[model samples]
Target: MVGVSKRVEAPSQGNREFTMTYANFAHIRDIAYDLTGITLSDHKQNMIYGRLARRLRALGLSSFDDYCNLLSEDSPELHEFINAITTNLTAFFRENHHFDFLKTTAFPNIIRKNMASKRLRIWSAGCSTGEEPYSIAMTLSATAGFSQWNAKILATDLDSNVVDKGRRGIYQEDRCTGIPNEYTRYLKRNPSTGEIKIREDVQEKIAFKQLNLLHQWPMKGPFDIIFCRNVVIYFDQETQKKLFARYHKMLAEGGYLFIGHSENLNRVSNDFTSLGKTMYQKK
Candidate 1:
């Protein structure tokens, strides 16, 4: 889209606006893909302009060219750029069926299969604000015999802001509304501020970290379950293929992979067999 110009209206002080030339948008698209494997479609031009314009204003720059140059130079503002471009949408047990499957079927099988080891490892990839891992902890806590098991949940995301929030384990009361009544005991509600925090026991089960899926991973995992829901939908098919292949390698044999409702293994990967409802089992 180089040389193609899209006018973006900025705040009017003396009738000035920013123009996002095609080159600027292209540079952003490439950088996003190279840094995080997120593919920004052409239709996302408006969104790109909107999100990046704030950075320009914050840095006191007048043009997208200046912003792009700063990014090229690998300034500290790169972190802010990634944060601004990334989208995180998650909730406690957002897809209720996945949790149900975990509690009713997967956990039972895992418990029996690992009777001798009594160890469990779960990774909540793209766990926004910690809800998913906390929910997992609650479900495990409710399970029989789980107390005797050595278990941990690793929650990670590309956004540092959300990872920090997850580490804090705090949320406004409404953000936790999806939590079932039975799981309510795992939360401590603040009466004065109407905020909720996961009980320390549950919080301790999870470790939150900032991670880019395209980058080299720090942990060597034979994870029993991986919750990468809603994350790969942002990437191109080739990227998704490579990512799923990496996931297949990381997972223990017969481990489960839960993805977004709209995503599938079709054409992208053959390493996992569909268990239905956006869930797959490693082959």
Candidate 2:
């Protein structure tokens, strides 16, 4: 939730001795891409320094070179370093309209048309910390009579740590604030631990996996719906185009693709026809 601002000057050339350098920027960019498939542009020079500088100080490393060397050491510290730099901001029902659309339009249509199939598959791409996929499961359970139907939600993220956390199905109360009251009733609150955990039935419907969008997709899918919202902002235009194309291939005929409000397929790809306002149906 921290805002990343533009850097006024380069760390090495600027008057400030503690500024980030070109070498540091390159190292951090490569590390980010290698670990999370997120490409840090030159504009993110300050962001790289701001997010990692404190870690460097804590590790007693005074220079970017030393920090980079530390990252290359292949220790648990290196894994922590990668986890700290990757952004994992997410909340339940963060974008409610997408869920509403899925419940009212997509799910109903899929159920009626695929009655013979008797199975539904939904993919929550970039499912940060589980909220998105959990929301999907809740929607299906409430609207689609989950007990009678066979349904599975595949939730994936590039960050292994967050993926593990999501699989645990535990969340802070504040994170569940926007969740519907009905859904809230299903969440179990443990007095001893003061942690809220998702109900077992809902958790069982979702399978969490670690996935890198930039790399080759491992799962075979002709998914009915793919919720890849709010993740492409970090990618370049070419990457975005390629990703959308891949999504087009992954989606089944008449399958739906939901992207972030800030993203569009207008310039990215023509394989998907716009379904109005951040929604798309594969052509």
> Highest lDDT: which candidate?
1
- Per-residue alpha-carbon lDDT of model 2 for 51-104, expressed as tens digits? 787887778877878777777746666666766777787889877888888789
Give all candidate RMSDs, comma-separated: 3.3, 4.3
The positional error of residue 210 in candidate 1, measured at the CA in angstroms, is 1.0
> Model 2 residue 151 lDDT?
87
lDDT of 1 by residue, 1-283 (tens): 2232354433322433688776677889888888888888777887888888888999999898988989965679889999999988888889999999999989999998888999999999999888888989899889897898889999999999999999999999889989999999999999999999899999989999999888899999889999999999899888899999999999988999999999898999999889999999998
**Cα TM-score of candidate 2:** 0.87
Model 1 is weakest, by summed lDDT over 10 consecutive residues, at 1-10
Off by over 4 Å in 1: 1-17
TM-scores, all models, native as reference:
0.93, 0.87
Which candidate should be chosen as best, given TM-score against the real structure? 1
- Span of ten consecutive residues with least summed lDDT in model 2: 1-10
Clashing pairs in 2: none
